[model samples]
Target: MPRKGIALVISAPSGAGKTTLVQRLLREFPQFGYSISCTTRQPRQGEVDGKDYVFLSREEFEQRRAQGYFAEWAEVHGNLYGTPLAPVKDSLQRGQDVLFDIDVQGAAQLKLSLAEAVFIFILPPSMTELERRLRSRALDDEATIERRMANARQEMLESRWYDALVINDDLDTAYDALRSVFVAASLAPFRSPDLPEALLDS
Candidate 1:
């Protein structure tokens, strides 16, 4: 029997290595596909439409919002970001899981709409370590880094809402844990009822 596709949401503060872990998971697990989000923010260097993000003007974004196009949408730092409903529904209908790398707000919204969504919160070892990792990147100024740290605290507090928590102290170990989660979710009786029959045949 074909089951609904699972919506796997991954949330983490900047520099928590969540992005790297998700990339690795996609590479390792071909059964899952990343959901490209639409955003009103201007694309950074090297970001391409439909690949990095579905870049849109504020007017376009607002139009879609009015039309009820988003499953979940939020404004962060004055930029609008939203997950399109069509692709996600289509993927699930086809039995392909969709991975969403979104912020806490979006994750919460998604959970309300997709009751079966699997939420995963990623965290650094410690706040001190998180700061070190953010600064080491040298991408943001001190003020920006400080803001991110503050946001990280808030995000951490909300981690309890997630279905799973991954401490990215070691990338390989964290990846393994995430893989195990996907494997288990896929094999769950509710997700795949055919498992019992297959096991019996084997």
Candidate 2:
């Protein structure tokens, strides 16, 4: 039997280091492909279209949403972001694992759509650490930071829905734990079936 592809959803609070963990996991595991999200938010200074995000106009994003093109979408801070279903479906059909760095709502949507998806929640060691990381970014002012922290608390409340949780206190250790989840998921009975007869004959 052919090796089935897996979708891994990584969720976390704003400063939980989820993005950094996803980057390292992809770099170390070539078999996994990153799923680029489409968003209506303006691109930041160093962010590239299609790389950081598929930056789309508000009209375009709404049109796609109307067409049901996204597996999941949400509006935050007056900006919309969504995970396009096409690329993810294509990658899985091509026998490549797809990694989604999405929020709790998106992850829940994915679970409903793809029952085989591996949901992993990356978390900070403590709320204090989470706040420190958020402040270190220096992108938001006090009001925005406070809003984000509140959102983070909500995100934490949703962590129990995930298949696994990795506390990202140490980057290397967290990466290892995340990688192990991927490895185990790949080897699971559902994803990897018995060897084909044709191959066994050789």
Candidate 3:
């Protein structure tokens, strides 16, 4: 029988290398399921519905939230974003580990709801490096960059609560550390819920 899968919830600041690490993890572990969140925000350019996000109207989002459909939900800059509980549960039942790429706020909410999940926080090498990386993107204005920097500081402060912290100074080193974390979590006794019973039966 297939073993129960895990929820690997990872959070990082905007400028951190969270996305890159997640992409590498998925590429390395193709069996892992990527968690697609639901959002009330309008689709951005080139963002496909259901793939990028399960776009919902305010009314539809509220209705589902009222019915406890979301595993975790949070509002950011006036837009609602949530992870649907049903899909995650289905993924777990099928023995496919689910990966969650979420912000610190959503990560906090997820901890409360999904206490069994393995939470990891990614951090930049330093504030200076983080600022440099953010500016390198040229995706945000000065004001937005400053705001994100402030947010990053706050998020790092909260990272203390996570199960693991990976300082993304070197891409290969960070990825190795992250992979180690996942490997350890996967091997944890609790994760193999069926092992003891199976061995006892034999």
Candidate 4:
């Protein structure tokens, strides 16, 4: 039998840079599929449908949710976002690992379903650095930045629950560390069903 694919579930606080890491991973390893999500928000500039997200109307999103189309769904800031079941299921069935840049809650639910998944958590170098990154974005108000920093503190506490953790102090160093994780996990001893037989033969 072929070696089964692994699920790479990565979660991070808002300013931890997991999203950037995941994007780089996909670009470097074209064989891996990045899980494209469905969202009820309008697409941003230069974002493509089905690639960036499966943009949906509120009614369509809710209708599909009712029809059991999504593997996971969550509402954020009054917008609904979800991961559709088909792409992920198809990728795994074809022995291709799927990478996800989801939040702590989504990662938890995914683990319950994809028990064999390798869960990873990304952390900022420090709370000070996290606040700095958040503020640097200039996208949120001061109150919002403070709220995110507070949430990051709580989310950082959950890092211990993951199988692997990487601190993004420097992008180059962090990417190297993240790449090593995927490479190691893919070839882990437990992944091969023929390990015992091969060992006996050797």
Best model number under lDDT: 3
Q: Which stretches of candidate 4 lie over 4 Å from their true place?
A: 40-69, 194-202
Compared with the true structure, model 2 gives a TM-score of 0.80
Stretches of model 3 off by over 4 angstroms after superposition:
43-52, 197-202
Summarize candidate 1's per-residue lDDT along 1-202 as a digit string, tens digits: 6766788888999999987898899888778877788999999999999999999999999999899889899988899989898888888878889988888988998888777788899999999999999999999999999999999999999889898899999899889888877777776677775767886878
lDDT for each of the candidates? 0.88, 0.87, 0.90, 0.85
Ranking by lDDT: 3, 1, 2, 4
Worst 10 residues of 2 by lDDT: 189-198
Instruction: Give a tens-digit lDDT track for model 4, residues 31-149.
Output: 87678899999999999998999999999999998997887789999999999877787787677888877888888778766777888889999998888888888989999998888
Q: Candidate 3 on 70-112: residue-level lDDT in tens?
A: 9999988999988998888888877889988888888887888
Candidate 1 local lDDT, residue 118: 88
Native RMSD of candidate 1 (Å): 2.8
Q: In model 3, what are the clashing residue pairs, if there are any? A: none
> TM-scores of all models?
0.84, 0.80, 0.89, 0.79
Q: Cα RMSDs of all predictions?
A: 2.8, 3.1, 2.1, 3.2
